[model samples]
Target: MLFLRSRVEYTKEQLFKIEQLRQLVQKSSELDVGTDDTFLTKFLHYTHWDSVKAYQAIHAYYDFKHKHPTWMAQHPIEYYRKLFYATHCRFVMPRTDKNGRVLVIFKTVDAFQQFPDYLQGLIEMDDLIFESLLMLPRVQQNGITVICDLQGTTRNFLRQFSPQFMKVVNDKNGVLPFTQRIVHIIQRGFLMHVTSSLFLPFMNKEFKERIFTHDGKHLSKLREMVGYESLPAEYGGPADNVLDTNLIFNHLSQSADYLEKLQHYKKRIV
Candidate 1:
């Protein structure tokens, strides 16, 4: 099993790979650009929206910029500016451990919110509105692990950052509205686990442990204070209804899968 520490390290390696790929993509001809799409398509076969592909895509674009500094300088200000905005848009952090593995961390809806005000002010001073918008705040896990947060509208943001990886469940084909609701419910369940189990635990351990270790008397008392008869299903508490049970199970399964994959990735890096 891989420790949380090593996972962070692996993420750095992945980031490096992404940067290299981006450079290669940038220099290649327009026809060659499709290669990245092909690569992404292959990557998408297994992964979902929050997969490695998104990380790789953003890095690839960064590499392109590095190789085409002069092109950016020569193009019309407005044209180049828009291109720059489109390509250099997402924010990603490199979370790594001693042995260099990626750590699982929060996926901020808007990474720019994580940036320091000073840095943001500098970007604004340069009149780099586009770049400024891309700045994101990130917290390193254990003060070493890197975390990535993407900015912009969620759909457009994901498309730019990880085009192939983000799942497109709803296309032109109309599905029942309830299906969308179900999907959201499932996604929410997974998010709750990430927030409560992964992020919240790091924030406060004693408080969390207290909830878990409490006897029925304390648990009941706490529940009353919180206004719930029992713990929510995402936290592994008993379900009050069939829908709750299904949602809880779905969340538990997703969390288990995510943790397992993270462990697997960490082992490879270690």
Candidate 2:
């Protein structure tokens, strides 16, 4: 499935262009309203795409303030009126087959939407998805697998495989603070998965502070499941540092395996 997350300022023409591109490459497609099982469930409790306008207003105010600090200081409401003009755009496109199994395609990583509400919602949704996908079991009987199609050159591959990835890279080297936050969420998810076998009390505490801090109530349940009190402070034994990287690589490997299995399953069914 082409799991997508973006700002919500896309014009009808731009949206159509993206849709046409998907149709050319993918056999089937669907839009994820941040409700897909892949990555959005964990983060966004509620979302309203219509709020894009409010976000644009807020951004415009900030832009005006940045450009004319003295004027903004004197006319705050006027500055806010200018901020309202800033629009943030985002959208999603997913592809699936007759059997209802998702076929991975492409995703756009651009913050095309200039509105804050829309951007915030997307951020929350992406983080949740990234975290949940990272934490899923390495292999599952009924789960979307993760994979890294690195066979093609970065440019051509991103264009054909996942244009969104390229947009992010070209826009800012994909190193913006927001991007880093998303990556960190993914990394934490990876560490959680690989180190599920390891048990320690302090480890849970650290997770609560670092990863689960955003959602305290949820972390409380996890802490209970692991029986926090029983874990020793130094229990992870020394392998915790590289846990995130290992998990990411493992997720990619498992995704590749899933693709192979999907092909085989399709053949058998046919």
Candidate 3:
């Protein structure tokens, strides 16, 4: 955190680059995102505090979004609301991780539900979840730790994985702020086995490295890592304050009415 604070202090050349990048983005896209200090700060952080690299990253992100317009396009908050309650619910806990990072729970049972396009729902959820995390100041700083509960991943879901989806996962992961702290894979089922044996090679190296596995008996380890008070009751922890994906969905869209405006691009998706 200290390093980030110190590195963000700009020299004259960096200021010039930031301005250049700002204009470049303004000219290139419909979003007034370049002018946003928060937007550029992500690029700056992702590029290891190099303003030039940050600008390049912004350009790449712009190009990527343009090339994949469908992926970047916004949807109704109601769509997200429904997807939240779908087979896969990625809800944030009412608590933080041991390192003061946000803890996001990815619990799934029947993941291949047909209500919404599975792949697209995953992407949209990623954006909404990150937006929700940013609402908490500590997450905006310390990032998030994911609890990927794979207790009931089906064989059918494993067969649905594609190179395109994996690529999107890696690409989008690079752009997001405070993205990965740790990804705890609880209950090593067949899906986890497939992911490690086949799909792991395709994912980002850092993402692969941070994943830790545990079975049902050791669920308390997560409570120890974060806190018993922070975890949800279903996870065998003591957090009595209830939380659900729908509540999390509401938290992200609460500040704005983009659905009424029919806006095509959500601010957070950028």
Candidate 4:
């Protein structure tokens, strides 16, 4: 239950912990981690300022990157340009919530079903979006909430995400530098319920608890949680406030240089 507090400034104790985490990073020859205050502080906050946990999380992060290089690859601007125009796959909301947490919406119905062959590509797209978001200090501190609209998608959509793959994705997400404050799955149908049940075992306890499901009939809870103003029109917000895929593409295009630098952080296999 280590919820992030609204401490814009680090406390004396946290400053000490940051240095401790820095020492841990410095001592480890295997961990190619950034020791800068901004970078290291992200891990400390993710683990509630526990230096040891932050160090371990950093290790896990780099290890996972080494294993899945495709997820870290920077795509050309044209690649994202085509992807954005072609599909309504994923988009981060244009605004942050009252808590300063960003909202990232995933259109499962459009994405999973439409592009079965591009599952890994979908994952790479997610990484790019998250990396872009995590670049913001406010987003890194407050974290983000995810609203996965699964209303139109069926059990078949779950087929592409097998137990093994679910486990890998879940594990990778757990050690991510950015924290996921909440995840609201809005859907209906007994099959969808069953599909959700199948993936629960792979989740860690903390993440499992953050999940909230809705039947799509009642979005009052969703509206209240993420704020009605923050949601797009598709999710019961103002019509004109719909997700701007073009804006996302533009942001990614601008972040091309920074994303390119991230590619060098992966462990080099001998």
Top-TM-score structure, candidate number: 4
Task: Please provide, for model 2 over 21-128, each residue's C-alpha lDDT reduced to its tens digit, 9 standing for 90 to 100.
Answer: 333323312221122222221111111122233223223333433433332112212222222223111111132222222212112233323543333333333322
Candidate 2: which stretches are off by over 4 Å?
1-36, 39-246, 257-270
Could you arrange the candidates by lDDT from highest to lowest?
4, 3, 1, 2
What are the per-residue Cα lDDT tens digits for candidate 3 across 1-270?
A: 311222345568757766766776666544435365455555555565566677666656655666665555276566666666755467777667667767788765565657536756776666656644544435545677888776666775666667876676677666555634687777665666665455556667777787777775668677777677777787777647465765566565663353223234323334
Residue-by-residue lDDT tens digits, candidate 1, 1-270 = 222212222356445554555555455343133323223222222123233554454344434434432211222223223222323332211222232322221123333434333223222222222121111111111111212221112432333333221111111111111111100011233333333233222323332332222222233433332223223332223464111222212322333433222221110111
What clash count does candidate 3 reach? 0
| Superior by TM-score: candidate 2 or candidate 4 | 4
RMSD of each: 19.3, 21.4, 5.5, 4.3
Report the lDDT of model 3 for residue 258.
34
Residue 234 lDDT in candidate 3: 77
- For all candidates in order, the CA lDDT equals 0.27, 0.26, 0.62, 0.75
Off by over 4 Å in 4: 1-27, 33-37, 71-78, 110-116, 154-156, 268-270
lDDT of 4 by residue, 96-122 (tens): 765679888877644554556456667
In model 4, the clashing pairs are none
Candidate 1 CA-lDDT value: 0.27
